[model samples]
Target: HPKFDMVMHDLLVLLKPKFVVMDATFAMEGNGPNRGIVIPMNLILASSDLIAMDKLCCEIMGIDWTDINYLNFVDQHYQREEAEPQIIGEKIEDVTQKFLLPYDDLAVRAQRWVYKNYFLTRLCFGTPFLNMLQGCLNVYRKVDEEIMGKEWVNKYWDNSLPR
Candidate 1:
C-alpha cells in the first residue's frame, strides 16, 4: 500500500485543509467505499484534526482504524498517538452502526484481484475483440438462462418493472 500511502501524504501536504466535514446522512456498506448498498443514517461529523476525524469516522463505521493502512500512515507522518478524538457534538456510541463487509465468495475475490492487477486486466481485456467480452458474457448468461427455462429473470423483471 506504499503507493496509496504516498498519494495520501501528497494530498495532505499539498491541500492542508484545516478542517474536514463529513455527511454521515448516508454511508455505503458492503464491498465499499465504492460499490455497495447505501445505508441511511442521519448524522453529520466535522473535525479539524485529520487523524482524529478519520479515527472517529472509523469508529462510527464500526471498523478498526488501525486495519486501514492509510490511517497508520497518518499516525506516523503526524506523530500522533491513538487517543479519544475530541468529539464536538454527539458521542460516537449514539451514532455507531455495524456495516456488512464485502461478500467473501471466491469469484468475488478473484474478480477484485484481477481488476486491481493492471497487467492481468490489460492482457484479458485490452484486445480489440476481448474488450467486448463483459457485454458478451452478460448476453450469454441471459440466453443460457432463457434456454434452460430459468424463471427467476422474468420474475425479477416483472417485479421490478413500473407498476
Candidate 2:
C-alpha cells in the first residue's frame, strides 16, 4: 500500500485511460474491504481526467489530497500544477462524508518484521511461498466476508444503484 500511489502513477503514465468512473453509491470506510464499515453515498462521478476525478473523490471522502504523497506525485507528473478541476454537478460540500481510512495493522506489522526485507519480499514473490501466502490471504478474506462483508452489503448497499 505504501507503493500503491507510485504503482498507480506508473499505470496512469502508461495506459493514460480516457475516462474513469466511480460508483460512490456505497463505499467502504475504516479498514477498507478487509474490515470496514459501509456508508451510502448515492452518486456517480466520471471524468476523462483521472487526477481531477480522484481529487474530487478524495475530498468527498473528507480526506486531504495533499496528505497523499503519491497523488501529489501524479498531479505533478500530469503537470497539473495543483489546479483543481471545476466540478460539473452537485456541490462537493453537499455530498462530502468523513471516511475512516484503513489502519492495515497486519500490513504495518508485516512491513516492520525483520524477515520482510526488500530482498525477501521480492524472493518470496517468485517462490512457492507466494502461493502459501496467497492461500492464507484467501482464507482471511473469506472469513471476513462471512463475518462482515455480506451483512454490510445487504444493509447499506441499496438496490437503487447500478447492478
Candidate 3:
C-alpha cells in the first residue's frame, strides 16, 4: 500500500515544485482520507517541505506523528534527527481540537481482524481463479521465450507475432 506522504514526496521529486498547499478543512482520522470518518475542520496548511506539511496535517487531525508510518519512514530514511517543523500560519492549539477518530474502537478491532485473516483476502480476490489465470500467463510467457530462443522460430514466428 502506498502511504500518503510517500506519494506526495514522489510527486514533489517529479515536479520539483517550490511550495505545497494542503486542505485540512475536512480531514480523516482513525482508520483515513478515504475509509475513516471526516471531521469538519476549518484549516489551511502550506509548507516547502512536504514531510512537515504532512506531519502538521496529521497533528491537526489529532493523529500521533509517531503512529504515522510515512513520517517515520521519511525520518528514518533521511536521517533528519533535528528537523523540527515550524508552524507559520496559525497556532495549533488555537485551531485544532481532538476530533473523533473515524470508526469506534470496536469497528477498528473488527477491521483489523478481517485484514489479518488470510481467508478473508482470498475470498475477496477469488484465489483459485487468480491462480489459474497466473498459471496460464506464465505458460504463455515460457512458450514465447522458448520460441524466441530458437533461431528458425525467431526468423519465422517473429514476423507473425505483434511487437
Candidate 4:
C-alpha cells in the first residue's frame, strides 16, 4: 500500500542494508513493478549507499527524482547528498536507456491527489480490493529480464514491439 515515492525512505529507515543492487535489464513500463508492460533494458546497478542506488533506479525508470520519497528523505537526513556513488562496474549510460514512466500524467496526478487529500492510503492498506489492485499494478515489477523477454528479445524489441 505504500507509494513508490516513499519506498526508498522506508527502506533506509527499516533495513539499513550494507549494499543495494538493482537489476533493470528487463524493467516494466506502463503500470509497473507489478502490472506494467515489461521492456528489455539490460542494466545492472549497485551502490553501497541505499539512497544513491535508489536515485539511480528512479533516473533509469524515468521517474522524476524530485518526486521520489526515499531520495528526499535521504537528502534531509544524510550529508553530502550530491556526491556521486563510486561506479565499480558498468556506467549508467552504457547499460541503460530511458523508459516510459509507469503511468500517464493524469493517473499519476489522480493518485497523488488521493494520497494527499482523501486519506486513501490508510484505506488501501486495510482493504483487500485496493491491496489486490496495487499488487497487480506492481506484479510485473521486480521481475527478472529473462522472465519478461527471451534471450534475443532485447535485440529485436524495437523492431518488433510498440514503444
Q: Please tell me which predicted candidate would have the highest TM-score against the true structure.
A: 2
Per-residue lDDT value at 88 in model 3: 75
- C-alpha TM-score for every candidate: 0.63, 0.70, 0.51, 0.54
Question: Candidate 1 residues 1-163, lDDT tens each?
Answer: 3267768877887887688988888989987755788999888888777778878788888999898888888677854344566667777798899877677678677766877888876776666556577789989888888876466656566665677
Q: List the residue pairs that clash in candidate 1.
A: none
Q: Evaluated with lDDT, which candidate comes out highest?
A: 2
Candidate 1: where are CA atoms >4 Å away?
Answer: 1-3, 33-37, 78-84, 115-118, 121-130, 135-163
Q: Which ten residues in a row have the lowest lDDT in candidate 2?
A: 77-86
State the C-alpha lDDT per candidate.
Answer: 0.76, 0.81, 0.68, 0.67
TM accuracy, model 1: 0.63
Give the TM-score comparing model 2 with the true structure, all chains together: 0.70
Total clashes in model 1, counting residue pairs 3 or more apart in sequence or in different chains: 0
lDDT tens digits, residue span 1-163, model 4 = 3355466556666776777777767777767666678888777777778667777777666677778555676678655445656776666566555666655567678766667854576675546868788777676553545576564676676776567
Candidate 4: which stretches are off by over 4 Å? 1-10, 33-35, 62-64, 78-83, 104-163
Encode model 3's per-residue lDDT on 1-163: one tens digit a residue. Answer: 3246577556655776557897778766656655767767777777777767777766765778888777786666643335577777678877767766556577567656666777865653556866786889999988877876576666677586688
**Candidate 1 vs 3: which has more TM-score:** 1
**Per-residue lDDT over 5-34 for candidate 2, one digit per residue giving the tens place of the 0 to 100 score:** 689888987897887898888999987676
Residue 9 in candidate 1, Cα distance off native in Å: 2.8
Each prediction's RMSD over C-alphas, in Å, is 4.8, 8.5, 14.2, 11.4
